[model samples]
Target chain A: MIEVRHLVKKYGNHTAVSDLSFDIDGGQVYGFLGPNGAGKSTTMNIITGCLAATSGEVRIGGYDIFEQPEKAKKLVGYLPEHPPLYLDMTAEEYLKFVAEAKGVKRSDMKRQIEYVIEVTRLQEMYKRQTKFLSKGYRQRVGVAQALLGEPELIILDEPTVGLDPRQIIEIRDLIKQLGKTHTVVLSSHILSEIRSVCTSAIIIAKGKMIANDTLENLENIYSGDSYVTLRVKASEIEIRRALAPMDAVMGVECTQLQDGVTEAKIDIDSDFRDKVPEQLFYAFASIDRPILHLAEEHATLEDVFLELTSQADISEESADDTEAKDGETV
Target chain B: MTAIFKRELSSYFKGFTGYVYIAFVLFFIGTYSATLNVRGTYPSFEYAIGNMSFIYIIVIPILTMRVFADEKRQKTDQLLYALPVSMGQVVVGKMLAVAVVMVVPAIVSCIYPPILGKFGSVNYASAYGSIIAFFFMGVALASIGVFLSTLTDSQAMSAGMCFLVLLVNYFQTTLVGFLPTSALASFLAITVVILILAVIVWYMTKNLLAAAIFAVVIGGANFIYYSVRPVKYGGLFPDIIGKLSMFSRFDTFIESAFDLTAILYYLTVTALFMFFTVQSLEKRRWS
Candidate 1:
């Protein structure tokens, strides 16, 4: 539903977003994952036509945002970094104003607003002025604003920011529900939020697209290697000897547990990740060293996110003094 | 555009700004009408509007200072930019809302001449003509105030700068008297004005090359023209500077027959400033 190509946004001497490109199809929750100042908000703003990119093109539902902003924006519902609420206006009044601005027909305005208010579950707070709302309610109002006009694409920039834990969970669940009918693109630094709610993710760092894939695929691909821990009925030297002939085993460390039982941690080549345990069982059986207990470990999304962002940070700061980082670490 | 207009209009009325502005205009105009038209037995109602035009300099800043400034301060302009509406729509919508607020006093002032005619004769043609001119003049001032609001996010700063600019515009005719009328003096004065214009362009765009080019083109043209026609420079610079004054044009309507030129001038000023407002907003997204 959205296509961004070679987008760049520069704020004078500082480059906020640079060379970022990604495509999002409809009917799924796509996580826009990035660390702070990673240009997530900038990219979202450009996509929603809130800001102009330095150079590049953004298309929404086959419409160029710059050339046909009115038609293009009609297909989008955007909740920016801060909820654009009039402090003096009641939530109902603000929603009505938004409904009218989005050109929702007068006949459908009430019904459309009611539907969004129901979807965002803002039934009770509709009459209250926005300034009186708590942070979570304010965010819900922002989300409700985006949900108006039945726009097929919803771009939310850090929707769960400044919300409490329970509110975050509610918003994530709300996003999951929204994903059933519309293409929901939400940017957040919270990995668990993306993992629990999003079907796919686009991870970016330093204004560049770094990774984009399904959650399962990303975990499997970037998890790198699988390590097997086993308790074997043999001496350490005997167990090591038995595993030494296997080409799949990259490295092995063995320790004597009790009497004749030995514990061994075997790092397997990623190419053999699938059959390492089964092959090891047969190999140990051939040497009469029975494999008693075994388990494999895989990396989590947190590890992947940290690894990607920190790597980008290092490369981004390479032109600066690396020695300066030492003091920060200290 | 209608959505924005309604919201802006409702905001003005919901808060005290609209009421306060109306009260200020009516209070001063009321005092002037009582003193000049009632007690002094003056036949012309336009004289009262003419004498009290200074209220616009103060009330305009209050009315328009928050129109765009508060949108920026609260970051609601993001909603405007993201909405299906164009920047032109937003600018025109808010301008029209301010015009509507300005119309309140104009409509109230209309009752004066009719009431004055009850006691004696009144020229309804010129009297009503002045009211129309007064409304357009308020709209023109409001447009300038709205444009000034786009320059900053702080309401206080917007109000301050608008007040300062309009205050200077109000006194520009009198201020012209203090300027030197000699050929060399006009030449140097115009050069300084061009330099200031270049500085403003630099501040807005932050492009030294663009500003430098503008300075050279305008300043160089001024030097060339002044050196070529030194004999024609007598008192010309002050008159040119006085041309920037908006309030003085309203005096033409009060002094003689209905001045269509003054109305056109007000409209042109309104259009010019509104265009600047739209461009300023578009520039913000790029820079």
Candidate 2:
């Protein structure tokens, strides 16, 4: 549904988004995982036709964003990082204007505004000036604006950044619901949020895309050590000696516990859980060792995120410097 | 375009900017009307508009300062850029919205001429013609403001720059009078103008060769012309500056001759500034 090719955005001598390219299919939520200023927002801006790329081509729904902007933009609903809003106006008034701007028919405009308001859950605050709304409500209103016209692709830039934990979960659930119908692309630095919500993930660093693949595939690629933690009523040396002869065990590290139960973290060549308990039973029976705790601890999506982002050595100094500058000014 | 126009119009009324603009215009009209029209018993309100034209140097900045510049500062320009709308549409839509703010008060002022007509013979034709001219003049100046606002994201900076530009334009007639009208002086001035134009071109495109070539060609052509017809350069600078002043042209209309040249000049100013505004917006994508 969206194709970004060799995109580069530069501000004077500073490059914002480097030669980045990616394609997003329909229906699944795609997470643009990047540290702040990893060109996540810039790429999102370029794709949504919000900011011009220094050099590149972006096509949406078969329409070139620059050459045929209006047609292409019709397919995109963009919520910028700051949530571009008119604070003085009421939420209803704001949504009405956006609906009109999106070319929603006059007959459907009222209903569409109402529908979006309901979707973003801004109905109660519909008449309240956006200035009076809390940060979370303001963000919901921003989301409501994007939800108008029912665009095919929804691109949100750091949508849940300033929200509280509850609001973040609400926005995440909303994004997941949005993914069911539209191609949703959202950028966030929070690894857990992306893993929980997005089907596919794109990890970017220093304006360069480091990784882009399905969540499962990414975890699979990073998923190497199928280690099982085993606690037994035996000494560290005895526990290691017992597992040392097991051919299925790749490596074993045993540590003495406070209650005289030795804990062993056993690395296996593969998933050897089924036969391990039985083998351990007989083996420990021979040694008169009692098993206390034997459980597998699988690697999570956070592990994958940490692994990928860390591998791409990129400086995130600019984003910090910019924020500092903005803070000083504000 | 309609969406932008409506929001802009609504914004004007929502904030005090639009009301402040109208009040500012009315305040000027009231003071000028009292001094020139009411007390002095001047038949032509056009004369009042001619004198009161300086009000734009303040009001145009207020009306247009936030138009594009504030959007950028707030990052709302992203919303504008992402929307299913062209930059031209956004520019023209915004220009029209400001135009409406300008025209509203002028329309209210329009009613004054007829009311004065009830008491005394208001030269209805020239008065209305000059008012029309004044409306177009405001539009032309506002378009210039829009173009300047696009140059920066800071509203204060935009307002300051716009005010400065307007200040130059306001004194254009007087400023032109200070220029040397000698052929040699005019020829030198044209070279300075060409050099400045070349620098501006280079700043925009960063194409040093093209800018140098353009500077040389224009300078050489003017140099040859001055050598060929030295007399032609005499009084040429004043005439050129005189023609360029949007104010000087308005004077011809306010003084009661329906100067088609003045009308055309206003239209041309509007078009030129509007074109520059579009270019400024387009440059954002490239830069």
Candidate 3:
């Protein structure tokens, strides 16, 4: 479990993470979704005790990260954005060093290292120098490092950035496996990855939390009035007249596709979206026009991400405009 | 801490830096041993160690340049900060690792004393005393190098800055003699030194107001002291510089007495620089 309250990180005059707050429960894969420069990495760094927040309180496993860093850090395994590998050291040696640093008992160190190597599937390349390993292998080694000591919380920052598609899937499966036992938090700009892997998602933009909920709930909540696109073998005016009396159809825009074919994009009211498809077919049949195509377009997680981030951008611009006006008045 | 210490020690031996440091120091020791003890027919091993003290200016930078700078450049410091260890432990662990590497050559040089004993009466008291002092002095300089390494992510910059710092410390005794020992001269020199300290503070913290306040307070205090008792200001600058020179303290061990104060001074310098190194690392998180 982790609790971050009003966390803020600033570099001189520029704020990286500003007044951010979030709570993560144990044993679930939580996706940290944000665009570039959205303070995801900064928040991860502060939670892992790798950075000092300007003013905030971060508690991991009931331990304050700043006050009881050693005790708190013992419950965390962090893999930074770059993997943080010692190029000269072998994977086994690096893992052993990490195991010792994480306070793994001498008796269990070998078994624990092997367990992580097995989990990350880095058994064969464990003896190879990390510099000789490819980026995907290096990322696996980084994950193996974080999996050591069996920390209750595993925090990774963009664990599959440069990996190929297969490697990304392997890492996703590994993270899903990790989620079964530990609380896994990973940040990525790719929305589909989050939708596929994470059970819960937190969306942030401009260093602020915009949305936090289960994946299904987020998609449903952001999925407003649905719409249907219909291709009718009728003229634009005739298609419009045919649907003009229908109360279920909220609005319709008819575009002439060819000489005799017309494409009508129908916006259905939320209450009638389901029955409108059947009603649409009968309405065209009665009008003596053939229905060429009928398809429903529902909102996806990608749309949710774009909408939230763009909404944040619009609000930020308005805020800047107000501040500029205030400055002129002063 | 042990994990870091072991890795640091292993890296030194695994790479060329540790071997280069050992060979460089031993080269000086071997040269001085042949010329001073064997060829010159000298009875003191302390003289050989004393003559070879200047080797630290070169050897320490090589040993310590990569300790923190490479970690930073390669972004491995994130691992260090995220680990279940304190910054103090990391710094002290690294300092001890460098100290172990430096002690290897000194320990090997110990064989020379007993070798000289077979032919002539080597004063084992001063010989071994200076050897111990020499080891402590190397650790003291290595601590400065560690602190210098933490200031930058470039290994070349760290090494160059450390070399320049030690060079200044090496010639500080002679440099002090060039200053005028008058009250006005000492007052002006002390003001200049305070201003330099302020500038260094500004460079590190980037707080111009704090640095300005520091300079004004220290400079004002020095001027008041000079006006109140001009005689007290005479020779003050040179005396302070001479006392601060780490190499000058070793002379007492070589020439006359095994000064416990000099040993204490070396230890204090080591502690002071080690503390600075820890603070520097901790500062990175805040900045």
Which candidate ranks first by DockQ, i.e. highest? 3
Candidate 2's DockQ:
0.61
What's the lDDT of the predicted structure labeled candidate 3? 0.91
The C-alpha stretches of model 3 lying farther than 4 A from their native spots are A228-296, B191-228
- Candidate 2 differs from the real structure by a C-alpha RMSD in angstroms, to one decimal, of 5.6
Output DockQ, candidate 1: 0.73
Provide the overall lDDT of each model, using Cα atoms, as 2-decimal numbers. Answer: 0.90, 0.86, 0.91
lDDT by residue (tens digit), candidate 2, A1-330 = 988899988998989888899899988899999887788878887898877888889999999998899999999999998988887788888888888888999999988888888888876899999889988998999888998998999998899998999999899888888888889999999888888899999888888887889988887688776678888999987877787788778888878788898888888755564677677777888998888787876567778777767766534556678889999999
B45-164, model 2: which lDDT tens digit per residue?
788888998888998998999888888887788788888888888888898899999998888888778867766778888888888888898999888889989999999999999899
Better of 1 and 2 by TM-score: 2
TM-score of 1: 0.88
DockQ of every predicted complex: 0.73, 0.61, 0.81
TM-score of each prediction: 0.88, 0.91, 0.91
Please provide, for model 3 over A129-156, each residue's C-alpha lDDT reduced to its tens digit, 9 standing for 90 to 100: 9999999999999999998998999999
Candidate 3 residues B182-282, lDDT tens each? Answer: 98888888898999999999987889999999999988988888889999988998999999999999999888478999899999999999989988999
Clash counts for all predictions = 0, 0, 0
How well does model 1 score by local distance difference test? Answer: 0.90
lDDT of 1 at A53: 87
